[model samples]
Target chain A: MARKQGSHSDITGPRVRDAALRLIARHGYAAVSMRQIASEVGIQAGALYNYTPDKQTLLFDLMRGHMADLLAALEAADLQGDSLSRLEGFTRFHIRFHLPRPDQVFVSYMELRNLSDENFAAVEAMRRTYEDALESILRAGEAEGVFAVPDPRITTMALIAMLTGISNWYRAGGRLESDKIEAIYWDMVRRAVTA
Target chain B: MARKQGSHSDITGPRVRDAALRLIARHGYAAVSMRQIASEVGIQAGALYNYTPDKQTLLFDLMRGHMADLLAALEAADLQGDSLSRLEGFTRFHIRFHLPRPDQVFVSYMELRNLSDENFAAVEAMRRTYEDALESILRAGEAEGVFAVPDPRITTMALIAMLTGISNWYRAGGRLESDKIEAIYWDMVRRAVTA
Candidate 1:
């Protein structure tokens, strides 16, 4: 059946995705069923099919959408200026972008094994593209003699992992303010990359 | 039922833990069943109870065992010398210990949500002790003016996360040798903390 613009699908589509992300994050993709997701969304089990064909597609969609949003946000951040400035920007941007989305971060990383090989490749390629963004900054800094990157690829992964790990323990009203956290991490990132 | 030492229970215990680790790492604790675990161990479902009281205990055991092993190994590393030396030792030791046990690392981090409140606290305490080992080094380095750490706790977590992230992608016979990988990570760890 052809549905009109912004119909039930449009309204329930986001609800479905949000519910799937929540359930999958809490119980893992392997254990979470589409029926559970539908129940969480206050819909009948069969109604879930209207939004996605199966649990796998729902999972793939959640991950793909997350990456797409991340890439879009990074593009919008428009990190500019010299390599050092851009590197700092990337460091802060990564933390700010990922810190609040703990569920998404958990589900995306934890549920990768559940994705089909083809889906896994797609998500991985998107991830690689994101990593390339940081590696490019490292390369630019290396070329400018501003950063002593012995291994740019490894440096990129290490820095990203370190920054992304904040989500594991950070709380909104924790001991440190977000700005202070960012500043501290920025210092380490700067010193690590530079001489 | 009394069992003799080095009998069937002793032999089957390790197999059960190994199978549980493998299955849980691949499918997650929420999705994996005791029956499947028993099947994987080539034992009857009922006999699986002889190994563990229930799945929660099994998961708690797996996680507790991983952290215990990590702590014991860290103690064995006997990191001595100046703060810098110990820090380098920690950087290398973390990578060496975690890289080869990807499954354990995966379950330890990913299955934290599935752990019971008491189990979670127990594991968290053990993990905290390990982090303390590194934080003490940073604290010492700060006192000696060898390192400039704005936040010792956050720094410890960040460095650990960066070093442990190697397990996510590092493979034996990969492009970089383990020794080379250790050296590269050590450089970042050193610069990231030092002035």
Candidate 2:
């Protein structure tokens, strides 16, 4: 039974998350049911509990996982060099990282009101950490005399919103490719922050 | 009977929209029912039909009403002068206009997926009209050699997204006042497009 449970966990866990993400993105966290999610995953309703305790946990897990993945990807990107270069890296990295995960991005933003106070704080903290990473780069550039950011915090929020907004409208077979879009946004970001 | 119907329609129409907006903003469109909306507005479930044909129409009306108000407000702002000055006016106008209408802003963006195809097209057309206003400003600046926007359409999206994002985080009384925040954002906008 233990071995069987482990095997199911390995394959079914991601499927459950994917299904939940899709449903929540479409219908929202308040509307989706455990039964619908289990059906989406092609599992019995009773068996769905084995994977997640409840709908709230599933939401918390999806949000937490998205932020964790974002932080991990940022670390893996290993942005290096001077603050300007790092800022550019951050710009391109943000666009690339978020474009493919529209559902996650939508759920992360739209479902915040649905998160329990404790869960909301956890997600908010992770978000702050991500924002701080960019804020640090802006501060470093300010110190290095290359950037003229009057308020690093405000600038951080502005830049992130501008970058993340790409996911809202981008489609794969669009007129401008991702690389071109990145270049245009990077140019704007570079100009917006330069001394 | 007609006089009585007109009286109720006069008072209840706005109430129904207001109730639907609040409920949909809080619980999302799929989760919010006509019965819940009626309960919110202190009306009977069947009475909601007097205000809207169905739930879809209510959602469409709320979204359409929000966009209509936005376009009307933009026109009222009557942004005048050179391209650069117009851009500044637009920036300040966007932040001020949206900050007080957070629920409208939230519902306008989040409930797009819930709109029917015909309703979606109607809303999208209004949205494009709004976007065109900004794109025209950018293009004028580009022509006058005051701005270096490579793509006016994309720049419009980026700037609007960055500006609308303020509604997401701004509270009633924060560390920065509205005018100060406007200055900071306007500064960034000015610098970003300056040739």
lDDT against the true structure, each candidate: 0.93, 0.94
How many residue pairs clash in model 1?
0
Candidate 2 per-residue lDDT, tens place, B100-160, comes to: 9999999999989999999999999999999999999999999999999999999999999
* TM-scores, each model vs. reference: 0.97, 0.97
- Model 2 misplacement above 4 A: A1-6, B1-6
Compared with the true structure, what per-residue lDDT tens digits does model 1 show for residues B1-195? 356777998899999999999999999998899999999999999999999999999999999998999899999999999999999988888988898899999999999989999999999999999999999999999999999998899999899888888887898999999999999999999999996
**iRMS value of model 2?**
0.6
Lowest lDDT block of 10, candidate 2 chain A? A1-10
Per-chain TM-score, chain A, candidate 2: 0.97
**What CAPRI grade goes to candidate 1?**
high
